[model samples]
Target: MFDVNARIGHWPYRPVGTVDDLLKNMDALGISCACVSSLDAIHFLNPQDGNDSLARAIAPHRDRLVPLAVVRPEFAGWQDDLTRCLESHGMRGVVLYPNYHLYDLDDPEATELGARCSEAQIPVFVQVGLEDARRQFGRTIVPDVSLESVGAFGREHPSLKLVALGLKFGQPDQLRQPLPKNFYFDTSNYERLGDLEFAVSHFGVDRILFGTCAPLFHPRANADKLRCADLTAEQREAIGQGNARALFGL
Candidate 1:
């Protein structure tokens, strides 16, 4: 399986272990590859440090890990950094931490950045948050990108292949609501029984991607969720890695 969302580096809220730990966990869970980003970049003073570390860490493990560069939309020369990540490091995508970076999807710079990514044919991963409000640390009350903004952004940039990680809708009707036609949801947080069937039935398997959200959430458990879902072979294949291969050009 190719995990659509995963991370490496030290997180302040919890222990993330090492790159080897991540790889070992993936191996145990039968996860063949993961598109990983650096947590260090989420709130770092020098964002390049995180990107540099990620490139270095994944150098020897390119077969099992694909780097996802993190960029601050408001920063000058971020475009150059993204270019280096693509042209030099061969990263498949970029991740945006809006709450941690203190930017909104409606920001003009963010819109321009999205346009650039769309033109480049690179996928963009938007993290809603590391954890839910109840699980967050006391002093750190990080906010999430509003679903309305996500839907709006998707509508504005039809070409942008948006992937929303940690996106959960409480009601079934919300599942059918208008979203970016090209948008996909990572299945890291989707674990309720019959949820996969319902989502697949409603949204089609093409819009769902396998994601473990490893370390933060157990890869094995998430893997089990899909493995146990009553889905057709084609649906399983699509959610497992087929959609990711096509969407990411892997």
Candidate 2:
């Protein structure tokens, strides 16, 4: 699951023991591969430091997990830092924390960062919402990362792929028609308020990927949702694993 919302200190997280521990857990959950980020970054301080912690934790077992670097694109020299990350760490996908970073998604820096990521062929993971924020104790005035900004960036660069991590229902239909060929979405948080049937029907199974936000949420819930749904075997497979493989070129 390439979800952007998982954290290190969440109540439901299973402590990661080793790379083997993570892999074995994924196997037990029927997940072959995932792009993981640090929970500390999503909940604690700056995302870059959290990313560093995650990198240190998973560096040895990179074979099992694909690290999606969490970055605040607004910070100075972030592009250089990102280039170094892609070069040294072999990171392919980047997760943006627009809410925690406290910047408008339409900011010029964010726009440039998207283009830079596009040039690097690195996909972006953005969150539409993280439902547990207020319940977990945090400040107010958190600016949401508007989909319109992501759409504007996508429109500007047709080749860049953008994935919305936790989109909710009635969240506006930007992806309704003439859908951006480059933008994709996940089915992790679809348990409530998501149009799963419509996504499969309109976006096609290939365009939607499966993500369970593991530890924070059980993979079984999502897997069961896909299983019980009225879809063809091929469609289910695409949503469960095939789309992920294609997205990551795995």
Candidate 3:
């Protein structure tokens, strides 16, 4: 399986463990590859530092772990950081946290980043929410990224590959249709019994990717969700890894 949403590094509220632990969890779950981003990057003053750390940590395990740079386009020199991540560090794609970064999706910087990623032909993973709203710390509450903004951004850059991670069960229905062909969603945070089946029917099998949201949520939970979903063998394979392989050119 190719996990499209996974993270390494610290989470303030809990111990997220190390890369070795993640690899072990993946091994147990039969997940061959995972697109991992830095949890530290979300709140970093210079997010590139987190990207750099991730690049180094994943360098030795490039065969199994695909690094995704966490980029905050609002920061100065972000262009240089992105260029280096793609060209120098060999990151497969980027993950954006608009809510934590405190930037609107329609801002010039965000637009420029989307355009650039489109031009580069790399997928951009947009995190909808890191934690459940009710569970968020009152002292450091970060609202979820607006689904409207996500849909609007995808419409603006129809050529870009946009993956929305951590979307709740009912959230996809809120996006205006017809949904962009290039836009996709992961299987993380969909806890309802029929969520996977609903996603397959609503978003199409090709648009759904297997994601564990690991270290924050157990890898087995989502894997079991996929296992129990009412899908054909082909549809199951597509979501498990085939879709991600096609999207990321793996």
Best by lDDT: 3
Which candidate comes out best when scored by TM-score?
Answer: 3
lDDT of 3 by residue, 94-152 (tens): 89999999998899999999999999999999999879878988887888899999999
Steric clash pairs (candidate 1): none
Lowest-sum lDDT 10-residue window in model 3: 190-199
lDDT of 2 by residue, 1-106 (tens): 3322333333323353433544566777666667787666665555666666777777776766788777777787777767766787777688877886777667
Q: Point out where model 1 deviates above 4 Å.
A: 169-176
**What's the TM for model 3?**
0.98
**Residue 2 in model 3: lDDT:** 92
For every model shown, the clashing-pair count is: 0, 2, 0
Per-residue lDDT of 157 in model 1: 83
Task: Please say which candidate is ahead in lDDT: 1 or 2.
Answer: 1
After superposition on all CA atoms, how large is the RMSD of candidate 3?
0.9
Pairs that collide in candidate 2 are: 7-39, 8-39
Could you give candidate 1's per-residue lDDT for residues 201-225 as a string of tens digits? 8877888999888768878877998
* lDDT: worst 10-residue window of model 1: 170-179
lDDT of each: 0.84, 0.68, 0.90
Regions more than 4 Å wrong, model 3: none
Better of 2 and 3 by TM-score: 3
Report the C-alpha displacement of residue 208, candidate 2, in angstroms: 0.6
